[model samples]
Target: MYDNYAKVIVKGSPITKSNFKLFNVNGRAILPMNSGKYHDRYAIYEEEIAFNARSQNPSKVLDEALIAVLKVYYKSEKRHPDTNNITKSIFDGIEKSGLIINDAQIRRLIIEEFYDKENPRFELELFGESSFSMDYSIKPREILEEKITYNPPSNKKKALNDRMNISAIKPKISDNICEVCGKGTCKENLISANKGKTLICRTCFKKLF
Candidate 1:
């Protein structure tokens, strides 16, 4: 079986599906601006994953089925969003990023969550089609941790440190709206930002700083 793995460090508090509210626009259902903004934050990391996937030759379309396993470490000062919703957002982000041709190709999926103060990230493990049956009963994080710990890699700590060391930069302006405030629009340099993470309004930004 062909197996590949990737680790993505996510920025900001994890967004859940419940954070999104659908509203009508010209008789069509659409997500509110805030939800789009949140999802977009996570979407930026798609490029990072795509770049790392060069060696894996991630199939844009799968000839055979595969099982996808995801383990998420959520970082935040506040309580985290619901687990199911976090997984939903991750699935959407990965699909949009072309991590897989479609999430549907995944015959089996495993999800687990952990809390991290300094480094919040998601680790993905893709097992290529095999003649053997896929095991869905194992706890993803426990097994992964056991393997990593027993066969420790030298770069493990350094990698975690690098992900946690991201500094605040300027927030991008999209259609004049600050991604964080959702209400604040048309202001350039809304707030200090983290790469691939947050975009808040000056007001909220000041509050945090």
Candidate 2:
């Protein structure tokens, strides 16, 4: 679930970073330059991508971690470009459009390829990472009931049953023991650590420091 999301479709034949021409300077060193036919094609492609992203009208540049899903369609099956190159182009375009502060903010990326003879383009989706949440609370009874109702003779069902059994018997940290040393201790003497997820005795705490 994402609070900030945007979808943009960029129509064009995707290009890769490998297309940048390399030049030799006095035969001393090689440098990559964004000049020539490849540069022209990539410039147009990036421009189109920026236009599509701007059409969505993002209020401000997003600086938070983001997830990007890219679907690339090629005009012909014979033409195959490196997915990483296309992804780089898309990210630069999105940044240029002021949709995101920088491409480095993208933490997760998914790319899928397909052939579309009629229309070749890139379908892009961006999601803010702040919207992601993790739920650790478990209800064994509810989970068991759901599993039993589905009752598929699969390994997944077996795994779920095992997990339920483990959860049911798992001891609480308030069991009057030092989890680190596996020794009995008074509950009051046990200090909470790791945001109360773990309980350790004062002796262990001193040793740790």
Best by TM-score: 2
* TM-score for each model: 0.46, 0.53
Summarize candidate 2's per-residue lDDT along 43-129 as a digit string, tens digits: 666777788898875565677888888899998766567677778778987998998889998888878888888888888887877
CA shift of 18, model 2, Å: 3.3
172: Cα error in model 1, Å: 62
Off by over 4 Å in 2: 1-3, 21-37, 58-60, 133-209
Best by lDDT: 2
Model 1 over residues 121-166: C-alpha lDDT tens digits? 6666666566435654435464444332232256796776566664
In candidate 1 the C-alpha lDDT for residue 65 amounts to: 65
Each model's Cα RMSD: 21.9, 15.6
